[model samples]
Target: MTEITADRVGGDWLSAPRAQAVFAALADQGFAAYAVGGCVRNALLGAPVEDLDIATEARPEETVAAVEAAGLKAVPTGADHGTITVVSEGEGFEVTTFRADVETDGRHARVRFSKTLEEDARRRDFTINALYARPDGQVIAPLGAGQLEDLAARRVRFIGDAEARIREDYLRILRYFRFAAWYGDPEAGFDPEALAAIAAEGAGLTRLSKERVGAEMKKLLSAPDPAPALGAMAQSGALARVLPGAVSESLAPLIHLEGQAGSGPEPLRRLAALGVRADVDLRLSKAEQKHLARLWEAVDSGAGPAALGYRFGEALARDALLLRAAALGMPLDPEALSEATHGARQSFPVSARDLMPERQGAEIGAALAELEARWIASGFTLDRAALLANLRKK
Candidate 1:
């Protein structure tokens, strides 16, 4: 019976024509449907609603038939799991039948579609995500007695027993911290019982796929401020379980440096700040791995900011400088940072083509290399004419 005021939840998304049409179609079939999960939670919190999901009393095939009868396309996105993607006005809405877990193995769950909202709510990982909103904007909380309070307090508490929830799907271990970073109050801290549960089940993280682990880590690090969550993860031993040798000590300072530089969160940069070899543990894409490797090299090269920018481009140069500053426990130099941007903008001014014929073959490359060094040393102020003149002197 928890109520979210209409003003708080009212928006075009709440009454979108297509979403309303889907609800009408379900109602016509005497099947109840309500917007559920993240869509409802975010709408109540005044956050952007990215995806629209609905939970229904109808079975998966019943949902498909109802939508199809209404001239809407039904996609069996997860039909075996009671989820059907109903397409209306060219937008896809995930319509899932209410389900309860029948069995769990820490990685996968066998669920049975249920007839009641309470059963659906109880199977959810966190209370904040278990909320539902009728198409008319009536909010429903059928699980935790404190579900609404937890959402209002910005707490990410597991439904029922924390350990039991973790045992159901160990990925919830990482998800707990990820949600904390994005939604939980850092000052209020994490739920102690949840932390205890996570610490006890820390080893379950290894049972997850590397891609899933990497994805959760990236999302966690992308939060506006992830240091507090990371610190907690370290204390709970979850950080080491996924990324051995990773520490949270330097992350706060790196975040401070990023803010000072007016930069937004960059996962790989923060990951670099952790001083762990992500490639060894995370399933990062080839491009990401290569970029991370370059970042490490830049930090260790002792190269000046401008040189870094010239070599790695502006964005990566800034990341390297920030990582280097965080590692050294030094404040970032504004002048040095500006110089990096300047270097990224600057061309070599003297390519091998300029030196071709004047010095043929390997000698041309050697001469350009020497000239480029002198040019970089001159703060990139040395023009092509000056560099060529210096080459002539050699």
Candidate 2:
């Protein structure tokens, strides 16, 4: 029963009215209830908690009744799996009965409800994620897992046997890298045993759904510095197992360049930096694939910032230039950055509407494009009249 000072993880989000009411309702039902899993883990790490879940001794139906009795909505988000989402004051808190996995088939688990917290903790994938917290911020850490200590050290380890955990759910292979990228300490480095286990089970990643792999990859690539974790993945053959042609070398410079430019990392851009066709390997959305395509086109165009901005709009043009600079190992030129900013703000002087009857159909379209190109060549300083004059001459 290790205790924690929740106030140290201080933020108004933790003490919100809805989270408090949900916890109180569960406790009032005469059950051992506490905020559990990722919420507690993130709170301890002083990271932003996205969701709040309550683990309780009460059964799912009882949990639903208790929540509804408290004037909140009980949604059976995963009721069959012992989870009932209790909506309090419009915010949803997942209230689940403590359960242990009776069976698993590498992709899904068959869990049986239990009153014991130890079984709940044992069934979890990682020790750091099994922590529980009372409303007042007192954490309940089961003995022997070293969850509290590992979290403090920023260590991410499978709860028991790493291979057994991986066998229970193959997704843990990618999750291991994702968590390592997000939270693992570069100083303490990675756990050797965990790495060895991941190396052995790396091939199992092929069994996962493309969507699951994509989501995890997207998040992992979004990390501020995912290079180290990715490098380890490469060394363990996990990265190649997941994405054959993808490499980590390109990501390293892009991260440094982003930091040097005081810009945040863009996951899509990072994905492009990996030099792979994400549309084929990862389950990226059409919009994401399009964004990557545009980013690649921008990088390959070798166009100046002004031209990039004119073609890609301001925000994307700036990002493209930044990536280009990083790839070239050159300091971001103030002149190029200014040109991109200015170009983004600059509008093309010629429009098809302006050439209506004078130039119709393909001719009109071609002439407008030609004039716009001339205007772009002249630093976008050419006026509509100048563009029209050029169009007329041509």
Candidate 3:
């Protein structure tokens, strides 16, 4: 494998003083250190790289000492797992020692730190994730055959034997689908070997913690368009095991409607689009749960934008309307979308105080409720005096 130089990376962050300092500090200590995995992959794809993780031949202690010697803070965030978080100029980068798994219980692995980059690369989940790049601008593809080609094609491939990789860590199963959704070019097709492994080892997914599974599902759903990757998961039976009741068929059209509305990636909206509800493993927040409840209710009742927005608030109502629009193949109405986003914020003029004293206790409640219903019926146009007059007549 040849070293891809810094010029190739081209991103300002790649050569930023903070990033280069990480590489220089480790190199000065005679350790082979390079920005590895997602950082390298995203940089290659010209995407914005968030975290700058480094793979090195140095041990955890050596890494900590090096970063501290370089006038930075070193935190052993995952020392037992061969990871040290090095903080430089307020930016933290994970510097993990090269490691190979000695034994695995599917959830956690017992790894032995090593000096070879190839060993570290081999242990990685995917080929695109295994590329390592030095600050000096050299990239290495150690164990992944055809890795460079696969990466160029935006192909998400499991490294080595797919089943063996899954056995090492069941979490990779979800990661595979997520990476496919985020990075893979669907037109190029998916790997059959990977799909087969997922189906065969589908049972292992239950062994993973709910938080882990839920986190991956959230990221997968948040993709710009997860339809194709989700379609593959649905076909492979993986989706059923993970989400049991999730309906993926509506996702494709739903995504199209979202795009038409110029919407960005939203996890809850995507999940609502599928019209799935369950006590499955995915951990969603209380607010998310409440919104989905209202979303489906509006979706099922075929509520118009105004009603949806009024009940669920503009953002959620807008998403629900778009999901319904996509499901029904109705043309996306910009005015309706705008209405769903802004028009539902109606304020009725009638209040309990206006009907109070005249109608006491339950009668007052009934009067206020009746007037409010009439106000809603009139698109919230009726004023306090009109409702009071109507209340007196009633």
TM-scores for all candidates?
0.96, 0.91, 0.94
Compose the digit string of candidate 2's lDDT tens values, residues 264-355. 86888887666765575688888989888888888888788899987888778877877776667677777887788788888776678899
Model 3 RMSD in angstroms: 2.6
Ordered by TM-score, highest first, the candidates read 1, 3, 2
Best by lDDT: 1
Model 1: CA > 4 A from native = 1-8
Predicted candidate 1 versus true structure: per-residue lDDT over 1-394, tens digit per residue = 2343543355777698988999999999999998888888888888898988899999999998899999999999999999999999999999999999999999999999899999999999999999988888888888754888898788999999999999999999999999999888899999999999999988898899988999999999999999999999999999999988898889999999999999999999999888875486688999999989988888888889999899889998899899878888899999988999998998888888887676788898788789888989998889999888877875
Q: Is candidate 1 or 3 superior in lDDT?
A: 1
Candidate closest to the true structure, highest TM-score: 1
Better of 1 and 2 by lDDT: 1
CA-lDDT, candidates in order: 0.90, 0.82, 0.83
lDDT of model number 2: 0.82
Q: Which ten residues in a row have the lowest lDDT in candidate 3?
A: 1-10
Error of 1 at 294 (Å): 1.7
Cα lDDT of candidate 1 equals 0.90
Judging by TM-score, tell me the better candidate of 1 and 2: 1
